[model samples]
Target: MPDAVVVEGLSKRYGAVEAVRGVSFTVGHGEIFALLGPNGAGKTTTLEILEGFRTRDAGRVEVLGRDPGDRAEGRALRERIGLVLQDIAVEPYLTVRETIARDAGYYPSPRDVDEVIRLVGLAGQERRKVKALSGGQKRRLDLALGVIGDPSLLFLDEPTTGFDPSARRSAWQNVRDLRDAGTTIVLTTHYMDEAQALADRVAVISDGEIVAEGTPSTIGGRDIARARIRFALPDGCSVAELPVAGLPVDAVPAEAVPGDGLVTVETRKPTEALHELTGWALRHGMVLDRLTVDRPSLEDVYLRLTEHGAPEHNTRRSTR
Candidate 1:
């Protein structure tokens, strides 16, 4: 089957400012694709174009095998899609069941309203009025409404903004279930961890252009970047006393320094370095407290990729 969404050389302009410039990407069927960028970086503009809410100034864009820009096909296109936006107003006087059931009427093949409620964790609140719900509960209601139509493609814009940690995790599982059942998801969020956890692939946009795109683990060369292993310095040992001769000499520090009773080793070969370090400590009868290993995180890569005026030449479009 064709990809769920495809945009090539997409661009948009408002007044004299170009809001999006030559953005191109594809979302595979049943894949959770994340579009990430800082505010005013054209993320919303790009989404609007795809959602048929706004027209692009230039480019080829197709969503669910239909051109969202074509007015004649707009209704048909919308029928196949679902959207959970940041601000969607429901009647304050309407109960959760009434609100969801009302939206279910708009789609040709809507899911059962009660089933959607349960999916979004609002099973017990079906009788509650919309205004009576908490901020997080209301967000769950929005999710219920979004999926009530049984859409093939769902667009989630900061879907868990008001959710507590526990609620957020529950909602993440709901999204996963949708993908598993053959729904394509297009997600946009400022939470790097959310993107890392949910997205099959991610595209980072900066200054209206895609700067990098890849799986969460490999994006921005995170997979190959230096790893940092840290632990409390063993007592009675100076930084110089640690075994370092077998480690990557070029990347390993000449003098393993300790600060605040901790020593950190930066190396490209973490497995080898860690085994050597731990083995040496065991032989010396020393204990390494609070030990931890880490590589560059999604957030670390995001901040670096979105730096103002950061060159766009590093774009890593997915070849999958």
Candidate 2:
């Protein structure tokens, strides 16, 4: 399938400070792509450029197929792209159904009004006025309006910012429903777990550059990062007599745990180490307490990629 979005050598600047430099990536059709970054990382600038709200200084940006820079073409393209912006303020007096029905008239092909409301978790809120809704409810209304047009592409800016945990999961399923219906989504959010749960692929931008881009599990080489194995020892158990034979002594770095009977090991090959450790414990008739294995999470990779200690890239991030 053709790419839903393609950006090449995209750069933007504000006064003396550069916001984005040579950012390039592609979003596959019907895919959920996420741009993960911290504050001032140029994420907002990039999304706005793609949405045609901000003009780019240089680059080839194609949304769906046509260039988003052409004024006449961009105007028509706007109808095909939906935007769910943060802090969207709607007319307070308008009821939920009235608000969605109004926006649905803007597009040539709009989703069913009642369906959109139900899809956005506003089914029971059909007659509620905008002013009377809670923060999370208003956010859901924002989402309803964004997708009312039945646009092929959707831009969700922190779509679940005000959602509670249960509501957030529901919102995630709603996004999945959109994707299953063949909508291409470009999401921007501060929550790593949200991205991990939804995005098919992700690009982490920092200091106006994309430092890493790949599947959430492997982003920033996380698949190769060390695994942390933790287990609490019982009374009278000693680290000296512990059984871990398969791994090299230096291959796994053992760390001291503060409690009386706790041990932690950081190793590149955790499966082998754990196998040996568990087998030894079983033979010795010892019960392992709280044994847990943790791989590098998406959050861990995100932190390391955007952290100040990362290696510097003197060369710009442009192949062209």
Q: What TM-score, over all chains together, does every model reach?
A: 0.91, 0.90
Model 2 residue 194 distance off true place after TM-score fit, in angstroms: 1.1
Q: Which ranges of candidate 2 are over 4 A from the true structure?
A: 236-241, 244-250, 257-262, 283-285, 309-320
| C-alpha RMSD of each candidate structure in angstroms | 5.0, 5.1
Best by lDDT: 1
Please give the CA lDDT of all the candidate structures.
0.89, 0.85
Q: Give the least accurate 10-residue stretch of model 2, judged by summed lDDT.
A: 311-320
- In the range 216-271, model 2's lDDT, one tens digit per residue, is 98888888878888888755778777765566464564655676546877788788
Q: Which candidate tops TM-score?
A: 1
Report how far residue 172 has shifted in candidate 2, in Å: 1.0
